[model samples]
Target: MTYSSDYLRSLVREDRVHRKMYVDPEIFELEKEKIFKKVWMYVGHESLVPDPGDYYCTTLVGQEVVLSRSPDGNINVIFNRCGHRGARVLNRKRGNAKVFTCMYHGWGFKPDGTLAGVPMKADFPGGVLEERASGMVALPRVKSYRGFVFASFNADVEPLEEYLGEARRGIDELTDRSPVGKIEFAFGCHRYHFDGNWKLQLENQADMYHPAACHASTVGPDGRQFQRRAGKEGGDAAFFTANGEAVVAQTGVRGFLKGHSSEASLFDKEQSGGVWDEYRAMMVDAYGEERTRDILKNRRHSMTLFPSVDILIAQTSVRVIRAVAVDRTEIEIWPVRLVGAPDVISTDLVKYVNITHSASSFIQSDDLEAFERCQEGLKTEGAEWFLVAKGLGDEVDEGKGVLFGPRSSEVGQRAQHVAWRDLMGA
Candidate 1:
């Protein structure tokens, strides 16, 4: 659907958006250039490449980029394409590479993204190749906030902190929960793909109204049978109830600026068992009892950072979404470990992801099914618009670029499209 900028803007209303927004191939292509390429996207955590020469390969928008750590303790995010033959210089997903040597031709670049060696130095004029900037091209801007690294192709995008806005609260909560103010990304990530638009998962992550309906089997009475069979009676109930109640406890959704949002999902203290006791003692020693309680018990479920990733603080996971096409997306979920917390704390967090949101997770399967069905349904000629006016006029000001409303409100979704329209100039 070829659309003028004015027409594109017309499709997005404060309370509703055209169905084409979710189904249009042309709109998705425009999004890659107008939004994803221009925003500060989460690449990977600094812990992913802790040592010099360590690198992680990921994509920004659609272009492949490598996040590498230099010998001088600096991080560099460079295009993976070789300066010589335009082939990918790094093939591995992640590794310790002293220099990236393109397999196509023999071109090598240092971890700092500078040209290191050429296959035959004498083949070219002495300083001609070197003077032509023959090296991996680094991204224009890169920054880290609390060890979460972000890179931007746009040279003039706002600083990471300013861009994050109130969304920082959830991220800070994630890092500050660590007794020593540090967290580690898990060694491996669990990846899942869906036959749907990438925005489907992003929007679904914080949608409170759907869980009770979509996940009825997993969290309802049927779950008790599964719990009993696994000798884990009441475990499912405790998990679901704690998160479910926490969502209800919140007065509204927090729709922060730039399409970011977070919702509190405080878990019960008993769920942590002795692990919370040990972690709490450490935190209390570092901080007072009141602060310790606030740190451990004040849980934020999903921090949806626009365009790419969502930080799942309560569950100790970081979910990165990558769009492959108009109706294809890949999601990588990484469980994180707090550096100074008790070993059991890390185990519990990782196990939560496996049970609740992993590829085989009972709860997540319901969501995936819904997303696929929505994609299929939207393809048919029926609805002209997707309604997002829930609690439209009832939203309350939460101050600091945040709007709040009932848990079922589409405040987050409305805020998200607002950013999309502004970014896409539509």
Candidate 2:
């Protein structure tokens, strides 16, 4: 039941994971080149190119970057090709281009990607249209911790907050739930193209154990809003599992690494843990309760930053998993508009993160039908190896991540496929 390459690198045994590592295709092209081209992905935020020539177009972990925001405001990213005939220069998905027209044989770029005018400026008189660091290939590693943003075709990784360990405290409890601590992404994204393969939606967002049996009675088990207001108008079912008691006190700071790891609410406090009382009663009416409890309990956790960030900080949401193979997957769902919530809780957290975590979700259609029926029964052949030995030897290495139990424990999907088989060596 193993497909060579040393039996798929011995299907990772110190705590299983070998359903052909989610049905291989050369282990999904070595996890898109050693874990999404050497990490730091999440590319698009800063209110998605706010103003100037604003741009957005995505894909990193699948190439094609683009990101832009030029015309003085700065923020570029680049690489949507067209370095003269490499074609595809901003093929939509976002726009406001003051200049990037490379509809082949016309060139012309600029807006921090230089080479701005090229329509026969003496038709190649001495032929050098902005060479030296020529532009357009600009991602020599981009950063942006707070307003999200990230990019890297690997110019030597590790810097995005030391590659976000302990999940940059889930981007500092999502920009301290914004009392101008910064958080923006004004209602736009809802994208999802899942048949399933993007690490099975990062093991269903760090495996929250299918919310009491796959979103039981539907996502409102006091996890907030799961209907049943009978005895006098709502609240019970232990008030939606005690409104996820800080996601069960974040399964004791869930851990794991090699790419990244996380599991459980990392501090949007308030399980009587003091400091998150309705985000300190609306950040004490705009920064007061000791600077709003040091802006909602001084940050310390939240992460999933390996093959492309997932730091969902109690729902500020940044989930991105773009594995364009093993069939098809690109669930880029981005949403972080909390900044100081309460426009009725940011319009009910933008309709509960675009209707219960977007991509037209019915609770995301039972996690896309259990990751597309486990990738169609591991693409049949009487199914050969798919065991991730669920909490094997009862997972508890605790050197960083293993102690597994609830929030649907497969222990963050076996510490994310043993850090995706040691960064795809399997």
Candidate 3:
């Protein structure tokens, strides 16, 4: 069934969207071509490939690609396939390799994705292939901002910063929070998948209404007391509550252009009179008292990068989203390191990632179960539309592409679908 632009636009409304958008195979295919490939999607952080010849294999919109460093100190995004039999040239997840040798055939390529050598080259038909043209294909555009790398297959796409728009502030705030104003992606990551669309995770991260309900078991009464006891064991009463779950505000949710949204709350209560005092003092020394106060006194929640990545400043975690099919999606969460900050700050950040967002996390487990259940419910043909009308009539339009409303409001979700509709040509 081919959906016309009118039909696609009809599926999305200001207050709701049809469930078929999440469950239709044809729609998913359209999304891959129109939404994912045409946008600037995150590839990796430069820290992941610190040295020349270091490469990390990853995927964008289900297409396998590699992020590698060239000997001339440049990062290159290369398609993982060998030019010769179309086999993958780099099999391992990551390594420092000067050349990639295809196991299917002895074809080799440089770390910068140039053709290096091909065994039995003399036996090839005369003039059948050219070595220079046989190198791995690179994406049309690649750019890095504040250490993060991104690529786009569309040569005519907007510049990276312009594509980011107001969402760039989230990244800036993230890195600026570090004492040295620099950060690094962590060495380890947590990867997992769910039986649902990729957009569910993006919406769930910024959906403030669910924490008390979906994460009731983790941040609820019993869990709070348990956490208190755990904190006591560690000789810190504010360990878990310092910029933790209960500190995030319900009214801080703000929607941005290009399907981006974020939650921001002043860290007023969380950064007072405890071990956090020492951390605050350290930040004060690095970046004057006022800036340190602003940094430690604020908590910025996750910011969604339209169709792919989510930046969670409070947790120092970057989540990469991959849509595998109509009903399946995978995610990889990488905790980040704030360079030159107090050791405890980094330790607490990693701790938050483990307990809240990792595969084994108490919070993520509940969310995953909810996602799978939502998928099951949508599969029954019992409903046509999913309501995002929670706070529809009362959105406050702050100037400059930012909308504010109750956390339960669908403003962010609506902004997301609006971008989806435009990109999908609906």
Which candidate number maximizes lDDT?
1
- RMSD of every candidate to native, in Å, equals 3.4, 16.7, 3.8
Choose 2 or 3, whichever is better by TM-score. Answer: 3
Candidate 3: tens digits of C-alpha lDDT, residues 316-393: 778898899989999898988888766666766677778778888877888999999988888787669988876777
Residue clash pairs of candidate 1: 9-426, 252-405
| Cα lDDT tens digits for candidate 2, 1-426 | 324455555677765566666766777776677677776777867787888887888877667878887788878788878776577778898878798787767776775677777676676647455553444778878888766778777898888776666556666767776877777777776676767577777766666545555655454423544312111221112314344443432343254555456665433323322233454476677777687666544233246766665766545567677788876887766666666655545545555566556866656666877788878877788745555444445456655433544433566666666666665553
Give lDDT: candidate 2, residue 102: 78
Regions of candidate 2 where Cα sits further than 4 Å from its true position: 1-14, 17-29, 33-41, 47-50, 54-64, 70-80, 85-107, 110-117, 121-176, 184-261, 264-282, 286-300, 310-410, 413-415, 418-426
Model 1: ten consecutive residues of lowest lDDT = 225-234
How far out, in Å, is residue 127 in model 1?
A: 4.4
State the weakest 10-residue window (summed lDDT) of model 3: 228-237
Clashing pairs in 3: 267-297
Better candidate by lDDT, 1 or 2: 1
TM-score for all models, in order of appearance = 0.92, 0.36, 0.90
Q: Give the distance in Å from residue 332's predicted Cα in candidate 3 to where it truly belongs.
A: 1.1
